[model samples]
Target: MADPRPATPTDLPLIIVAIATCLALVVFTAPLTTLDAMTDALGLSPGAQAWIMSGMPLGAACGLLTAGALGDTLGRRRTFVAGLWLTAASSVAAALSVNGLMLIVMRVVQGLGSAGIMACGLGLLGQVYDGQARRRAAAVWAAALGAGVAVGPLIASGLLAVSGWTATHWAVAAVSAALAVMAMSRLPESDRTGDRVDIGGSVLLIAGLACLMSALIEVRVGSTGLVTALLIGAVVLLGLFWRIERRTGNPILALELFRYPDFSGATLAAFASGAGVLALMSMVPTALVRGMGQSPMSAAVILLAWSGVTVVAALASGRLPERLTPRQRVIGAIAGCGVGQALMLAAGTGTSWAVVLPGLLIAGVSNGILNASLGHEAVQTVPPERAAMGSAANNTARYLGSALGIALISVLIAQKSGAGTDFFDAWHAAVIASTAFSVLGVLAMLVVSRPRGVVR
Candidate 1:
């Protein structure tokens, strides 16, 4: 067969990145509606409710480590197909869920599938593309996924306007199904190999993470006993995982990887980037709707603005990595977003959506740049044989950041977002927090630079 076009997934990097965006689009939009209505429908207390809400991130974290390692070993196509199918199935099940617990269970499954796509996709991409092409592909994928996420709310609002909220899941499920079929036919297989799937370590990791997530999601929800117990259990399980992985010949995470400061710094920077942006993605639009008394569609329109800027930024990211030093680009992106978030906070306080929108635009652009820039840094740090592990580690930082993002924002909103709460005030607080995260991201970049020598 003639070699496929540059953009085709017959090139594994292209295919996996395409699949990642599709998968990300499906559920990310669902949250916009569900978070508002879910507690009422689930009949669960507020704290207990976000458990299912947070479960998506938790599940992804659990599935990513194992999926990345095995994708290299078993075949990326095999895992990609399986993960897409499973994600589609879970979406259908989620649409039919009657209670909070049932939906959480289904969401966990959905997350598991998402993790596979995310972990396997990056690893496969690492193997399929060379230096500059890989960076470009990563940037394009980041841009595409940002677009999908941006489109989700607009699509969800329209679906909810005509049909029930549950119908939206069906719509998302259909998308996943369509992507799965395309994936089976088109996605190129991974070229590298790795150790066997670490079943034991996988279980421990999941259990530990589940416990930790559960503890955090409930800590402020009035469950001191259960939350405390779950946290202790999580700590023990994670400790066990560390000990086991250290002794095992093939561990899920290679400890040696962290010894390289660039890998570690890039991962840390990625994590902070995820936290700041993901949290903003969730809270900012809601603030516009509830605090400012804007229409749902209006709120979504603002989000579209956030998404729009990201696309422009991502396309430009391939150039930044090539044109600027990694440290310069990484630190600049973080600090730039920090300035944006600070403006976002200041504007959100009064009539700043109009003003704050600019900040969000900058923030989105930074995010686009970072996601691609970080991936490039990650793939370069490790040997070709260990690329999947590196990919998994890279994604793990992003997911871990996302988990923290959800938790931090949830706590902030819950604590401050009562009936008496000033809509814009809470919005301001959230933006300030986002700004703080961006500052920390800057710190991460600066700290790393002092030791490594300035990229400039």
Candidate 2:
């Protein structure tokens, strides 16, 4: 069949998508370094603090699939522009929040906005570029993801030093507003399916994800009964969503896509990337601050060793020999992350931060490769019209995995610390568990990507 992609023009679309994606991530992670200040200023309880941190991911998890479907159906440019505006408004609301609950709600709204940008922005790129150009564009998108993570904390910390936690939100709001204006003016409209939006499926899926993510976030603090009920609700809601999708003429997410090995492998790899390396890295600053007495800004800088390297690695991944398939790159990178995480076993209370530097750097490279490969597979493995849905599914898995990973790691650490184990010792256990998640991901990807006729 003849290719449908347009001839390459100016790189304006790629540049816009990259910046929007990066900005979305920046908003997502801006609270990481400023958590203490936020907690103090908002008078947050532990539970409220947890919500503040988890709200955005929870919102993203709920909204990504729906946003993708909308983008593909309505118009990618329209959806993307709406997302930017939503993010901007939400940021301003968040900046003005007078309490933890308000802030958490605004953060979730921001996540919803980010979901539109993430899924549709990549989808737009997929529509604009094909073949080698597509590959390189995906690499740049992946690098932008890493770059945002690397810079978010630094920006937050710098702003906090000068003004306060709210300043970070104001800064994000301003940037988001500017991007919204730019996107509306410069971005091209993509072809749309003009199908009816799956209202039933969207509602059910969003509710189910909300229940599931909320359960995960509350696992550390909520009563056991509450968590169990939430889980049950999630299961029931999701099961109904599945049935609805099966019967509906226009489903939000086409389940048949899972039959594609590349798509399935990419999804699993994204989950593993989140549950393993991303989850572990999220906790690094905490371990450094509480266990090693490092200042918040110091910890953020230390983390740059991993996140900064990831940007470089992601950009370089597009240059890898074509003989190496995306599946091979994902599996190898995940395994590499496992090995790098294992290297952190030597860390101890008395050790310098430099002890984990090698492991961080190795994991950084692995993460970079994994990100680029997943981004490519996300758009490549799916039908051209459903590019946004593919990106949504990949990212939904990632955020869900991260939530579960963070909850599990927190439980393990709490258990060990409560039992009088040293903080560093508890951290060691988390490292081991996270590495195990990576190994499991590698195994899962292998099975998913196995040769068609080859049986174990």
lDDT of each: 0.71, 0.88
What are the per-model C-alpha RMSD values against the true structure?
A: 3.6, 4.1
Q: Which stretches of candidate 2 lie over 4 Å from their true place?
A: 1-9, 418-421, 450-456
TM-score to native of every candidate shown:
0.89, 0.95
- Predicted candidate 2 versus true structure: per-residue lDDT over 1-456, tens digit per residue: 112456454577888899999988888788888989998898999999889889988988899999999998999889999999999999999999999889999999999999999989989888888778788788889999999999999999899999999999999889888888888878888898888999999999999999999999889989999999999999999999999998887788999888988788888888988999999988888777777778888988999888999999998987787678777888899999998888887677677778889988999999998998889889878998889899999999999989888988888777755322377778888999999989999998898865332111
Candidate 1 regions off by >4 Å? 1-16, 35-48, 191-194, 348-352, 418-427, 449-456
Best-matching candidate per TM-score:
2
Clash pairs, candidate 2, are: none
TM-score of 1: 0.89
Q: How displaced is residue 225 in candidate 1, in Å?
A: 2.5
